[model samples]
Target chain A: MDSIEHQDHPDRELLEMLQEAEAKVEQLRVELDRRREFRRQMRADEAHEGTDEEVERLSEYLEQAQINWQAVRKFFQSAIEEYRADDAWGSGRPGA
Target chain B: MSQTIRDESTDSEHGVRQIEVDGADTAAPASPLRRLPLTGRPLRIVEWLAVVAAIYVMITAVGAIGSGFEAATGGQAEELFSFASNPFVALVIGILATALTQSSSTTTSIVVGMVAGGLPIEIAIPMLMGANVGTTMTSTLVSLGAASDREQFRRAFSAASVHDMFNLLAVAILLPIELIFGVLGTIADWFAQLTTGTDGGIVTTIFTAFGDAVSAVTSPGADLIEAAVMGILPEVIGGVLMILLGIALILLIIKFIANMLKSLLVGRAERIFHAAIGRGPISGIGSGALITVMVQSSSTTTSLTVPMAASGKFSLWQIYPFTVGANIGTTMTAMIAAFGFSGVEGTAAMTAAAVHLIYNLFSATIIFAVPFLRPLPVKGAKWLGDLGAKNKMYVLFWLGGLFIVLPAVLIGVSTWVF
Candidate 1:
């Protein structure tokens, strides 16, 4: 019985990574859009003017969304790098 | 830093992933009663029985406290509250009485009884308003129990104070208007007129009969205790002892009732709240009101939200309308007591009760219905909770100042100045 089920296949791994990254990116984008819309609505509602606490809360939310976006971007970039490396190896290792 | 990831629970079988369900985790041995299956039913039945017992004990305790107050004051509560001719004094009296007893239902019910017994409606009205303010203190005190953990305290305190802030804000807006315009009084008078006909009314008949029955059962014990205490101690001290006993009984009984009810209904409460969230604020308020009416305690209903809020299951906004509903629901006790009166006194009692109901209804409508005003209590409570989280002294100061020191000073000043 083999302990290791399979060897690393960068092409397959990169494909899965791309799917995960795509979902993360979508989620982050939705969250950022939601926060931005909420902040914009708050600004429109002049009744809550001068409430620094609300402002701080919205800022914290925006910061979180930005952090999520950065992580998603990083994941996408790594997925692209893995895909490129796999393509190069596949071309270089030809049957003689 | 590097981290290793593992998915050991998943296994490859025939090139397909297989996941384990662990059926053993869900199975439990059954009892010998195969013909009848009872799961969690017996425990729930016992909890509900305890809940009823706790409520009866609480009612008896409130009766004891009211009787003690009357006995201790030598029926001088009217004289003590005479300075309440100044609405603020009466309001302060209401706050102190409810804070001391820790039940607005008790305080407002007492006010209703007093009004029936010939206490002026004007004085009783302010006291009733004070009860609304004072009752919030119980949940606020309950929230303080979470103070060891700053974050928990912050969330719980905010959840608790939202109720306090709403009531205080309501009083701020309504009390002056009440004093000048007499709008609540007029509305209550109309309600009283509408209900005064038809053989003392169904609500009144039920409440009066309930009140008499409760008194009959509890008064002898209270009187016996009163007589015994007076035999050893001074008359005033004996009265004071009764008051202290009543307060202790109320706190203990309410605590037990809340725990029992929570045990029995938490899952149901969570479901109700979840459903309320989907249905919007009206449904949330209705659930809050309904629960409070069932349990006969707004403090219990509101306090239940603290742990939920602290655990992040609910937000301040979601619980805000529910707490408002608690305010509306709590009026039922006072309203029920009002019906115990007959003739002019009955009219006065019902009037006072109507004032309580109208006050909560008007406050909820005016504050929550107006988009501009809706968020003030929530915002105010959040700020206070944030401040208190940073420094706990603020919590102590709020409890002491609003419930104790301030009420004491106002009452003293009113007595001296008025």
Candidate 2:
């Protein structure tokens, strides 16, 4: 049944959908990285601006953002791992 | 059973879970935006408070001085003039007292009050000159703070001591001329006549009112305290307390006033001075006058330049003209004080103040305008500063000779010879 589902659909259409989804994810990841880099640059600029008070505030914001991003990244990675494990278990069922 | 449950939960059938995860990811970017703190609001409040407190403290301190004086002197304010009967003695006393106290304003105010109370202008004039000399002690003592650093101490000490040397020079040249020719007295009298006609005016009225108000508050309290202590302690203790209170009040008020003025106007004043100092003799004189008027004491105005000098921020040469300006500025106090007196005494007081002004103007013109005399104090101060740097004992000796021993010797000689 899995083979039929894989073969009945045109390979090109399936590949295109997967490629489109991956392209969107890659674009978003790049945007996120660009923004992170921009933020880092902004922090560096703020440091050179010679205002201790301003630099302190910017540093604190950067730290909180870093912590939130780490938690989100971990959440997504764990969810992906759980989905993969369930797919394997379902595929290996004795009835199949 | 657990595998089938997990598969069901992870399957595409759970569309709500995917939507929630997507929503959470989308919201992650907004958290960074929420983190900035508010700035400048608290600092603004603090600055305003400082200004208000400074003004209040200054007024209270001035009021306290007046009160202390009234309490201590009572109806015997006239007796204060007895000390100034001998001009030389008055001069020495002014110098000694100011040196000990380290404030010209205190010495000048006391002298002004005594003059208003009936001290001769001639006697008070010399005392004013002494006060000018006496005020130099503060910066000299300040220089001692830098003593551990040799070069810094030398620079600071010289910068500090130069004020003393200049005043001494002024006194040396002018005193004899005044004694013989009565030059200062004559000039002062002429100015006094020209301005107030017969002497006494608005200045006296205002000061009297202010002094009366101060005395009203402090006198009763002081009298009660003195009465309470009469049998318990020597009468001299009351007298001492009165004097101390006067000194303390004056010092505290002047400090508050200085702080207020500094906070309110120093930045602008400094800019004005910098511009003026660069503009040749006229500008230098103008800058010095403005600073003195603003600060209200030439000693305070002139001494302001000393630390800058010692720090190598500006040279002694640049500051010399400003010092001349300060000399003129200091005379304003006496001039104002003169207005508080009337008739011949007022004329005398005004004249004395005028003499101080004229003498300084004349001295600056003669000493500073001519390149030859300009370097004298600088050279003398440098020599003494070098001596001080080499042996810290010289610093002590300088203090003793200028402030204590010399004044004592002069007083002794005047007593014996006159």
Candidate 3:
């Protein structure tokens, strides 16, 4: 009796197709949510990396403080004028 | 007879030849590139003989000074060198004398002789340290040659000043200990006692034999000179004149020997120096000391490194140990000078010489072994070199401040303020 009844229904196939489409939409929505979360994590990692670079820059600046680079540069400016390149004595100097 | 011959010929090794003109414009052909003279067997023999002669004269001169000093003061020599009794004055004298002569070996050897002639051991000890400090002046001067190029001058000056810094720091540390504890004098005397036989050491026999042989060869000349001077002038005046003559002879002969030896040993020494560089600090120091001993001049040993430093062949740290080694090697001259004396005089002289050796070795051992202390000289030198490279005025100020004004100020303080 039941078999005869089901076989008689005209919209039964269409209803099954609609159910499959809804399941696919839920799967797609979960994937989109994962991608958005991953994007946020990557941005956080980039910000942390930038901080490290800033720390290194500051350390370098501090090291330069120990020696008066301004004075050294100023002196080099004048010294370069008087500096001469003479190989009069080099590696061949006797009494080595 | 000339031992060296000159020739104008092509040298494939150096590709050095006379310049040529394209068309017979013949402006006197440029002087041919000539090679340094090659040494023959006869020349080697002559060189060795000259070396022996120099040593003979040097020892003879030392003896003359000792006897002359004794006679002049009538065995009460305390007052004669009284001004130098203050350790600071003695130190300044050592620095000034060594700087002017450009030879610490000469200064240290003279100090040994003066000690043998009754200069108080306390005074001689500081002078020995000063002589070590003063020897660095030679390399500093050599580095000035590269002053035209900022980088080269910086490197050269740093290399050279590492030596000066190490020595000056050593003095700053040791002199105070030396003053308060007098440890150098005590240790020096102990060794002196070993050679002099007060402690029954077998070295006494060897030391005596060496001294006797030296006396036999050198005494006649010294005696004849003393007798001739004494014959005409009063004993005191003759003594003074003999002392002056002895000093003159020592200065002249030492210069001659240094020049001769430098010419002979330079190539061999250069090879040794190359082999040792970059090996480590120990090898650097060892080769430095060895080359200095071979050529008999610490100045020559240290000056050669200035060029290498400027050329970037080695770092300042690498050359630092070598300079220290030169300091060690130069102590040999004082030891040799000490051997020419015997008895109480011998003991005093030997103690002074030993102090020179001990002070250098001890300072080197302490500074190099300590991780923190090792870089002190290098850092100080780098700072100074950087400053010097920036302005020529700094270099002049350094020369004046460290060598002249500082020592002068110390002398004044030691003499009057104290």
Top DockQ prediction, candidate number: 3
Interface RMSD of 2: 29.3
Model 1, runs deviating above 4 Å: A1-96, B1-80, B198-268, B339-345, B408-418
Lowest summed lDDT window (length 10), candidate 1 chain B: B20-29
**In terms of docking quality, how is candidate 1 classified?**
incorrect
Better of 1 and 2 by DockQ: 1
lDDT of 2 by residue, B1-418 (tens): 0011111011112211111121121111121112223113243244346544543333333333333444456536447657656667888988888877666766776565444434566776788788878888766765665544667767777877777878888888777777788777777667666664533567555544553454454445444544554546554455446445645755665555443443334434544653554456677677877877665666566656555555554556566667767777766655544444444444444555666678778777767666767788889888998886655556767877987788888888877877
Candidate 2: where is the Cα deviation over 4 Å?
Answer: A1-96, B1-84, B199-249, B336-349
Q: Would you give me the overall lDDT of model 3? A: 0.72
Model 1: per-residue lDDT, tens digit, B1-418? 1112111121112211111112111111111222232334453455567776665555455445545565667766667666678888889888888877767887777667556545677888899999989888777766765554668868988998999889999998999899899999999987876665345678656655665665566556556666777779877687678667766766676546544543343334433543455356788789898777765778777776776566554678877998999999889876654544446655776788899999999999999888888999999999989977655556666877887887778778867776
TM-score of 3: 0.73
**Better candidate number, 1 or 3, judged by TM-score:** 3
Top candidate, metric TM-score: 3
For each candidate, report its DockQ versus the true two-chain complex: 0.01, 0.01, 0.02
Docking class of 3: incorrect
Clashing pairs in 2: B188-B351
- Where is the poorest 10-residue window by lDDT in model 2 chain B? B1-10
